[model samples]
Target: MESDNKQPCQTALYEEEETLARLTKTANFQGASGINQQSLNFRKDQMCDSPAERILKQLHNKQLLIVNPKRRNGIILYKRYHAEFAGPGSAVGVSLDTDCQKILPVGNLDLISPESADDRQRAYLIRRQWVRLTLQITENPEPIGRAQKIIEQFEGFFDSATIAKLPDEAFSLLVGVLPHTVAKVRGKR
Candidate 1:
């Protein structure tokens, strides 16, 4: 029985290698040995800011945070009554209708990851940089549709259980909908 599973795993691995080889050929990717250390260092310096630094810069600039898609990190922005959840590839703060990016008192957000507790703690220390995005849904012709679009954007990156943890109030606050309305749309899930 174990060998049966192993056989399929081996076949999948081989297929993956073949696909990678074809991609490399098509992209003209020279092997790792061809890249010099100076080029690698320059690229790293340009693109690899410490995670905390990146978060700070985004919030400070009031830039809609486009979370790194390759990472599993998620962030939550908490207000007095609600908290917004943003997963990878989702924009967390700032919206078109409003320029409210207040992050007063700094304990308003948390970055979560499946990694070690140390990483979670590190994120907490950087919570002061967290910014809240205020979106005005009433201005939209279809308020409910606007709310649903916001909900779906979050749903795209998080699992059902993760979504469940976020209160209806959070979603409502995000898109300026009633909690009950958020519940109604969520039920349609």
Candidate 2:
């Protein structure tokens, strides 16, 4: 009799775990959609009045939502969890220029560089290149083919460039930044 009762309880626990896993996956998928603020607000209204806050609370106790002061009306934005694993907004890494030699670190790249004009310019150019390339690659119907062509065309762009001229310290910094950027740019619908 006790065994029979325990069987049902175990089944219930398994079901609960499955449900939680599905919910997490759905939340991650929706979050990664990169919906604009208005769309996000609409989604929140349709789904939950405070979706981000709710998700954050679920992920971490004592978590809070904060507003973006830059906007005219402060918009409530949840603090990103693990960016790589979280949502699209919480992506990691930096953007690089056409040469694939320069880097513009995301989130905190500015803090890593010196306050020199040349350094700032280099960083800005690198970021611009990254954005340009990202747009070009994503907008293409055959991104892989296009990217290959572009890469081949600009193969030697970085040959003359030296690491000393770059604002970053390590070549791995450039390497590390690509996966997140690719994920962000290519993971979209």
lDDT string for model 1 (63-133, tens) is 44343334444555544454444544344443410233322111122322224555444433333223232
| Separate clash counts for every candidate | 0, 0
Residue pair clashes in candidate 1:
none
What's the C-alpha lDDT at position 154 in model 1? 62
TM-score of 2: 0.23
lDDT of 1: 0.47
TM-score of each: 0.36, 0.23
Model 2: per-residue Cα lDDT at residue 140? 50
lDDT of 2 by residue, 93-129 (tens): 2221111212222111101212355654554444445
Q: Residue 105 lDDT in model 2? A: 22
lDDT score of residue 164 within candidate 2: 24
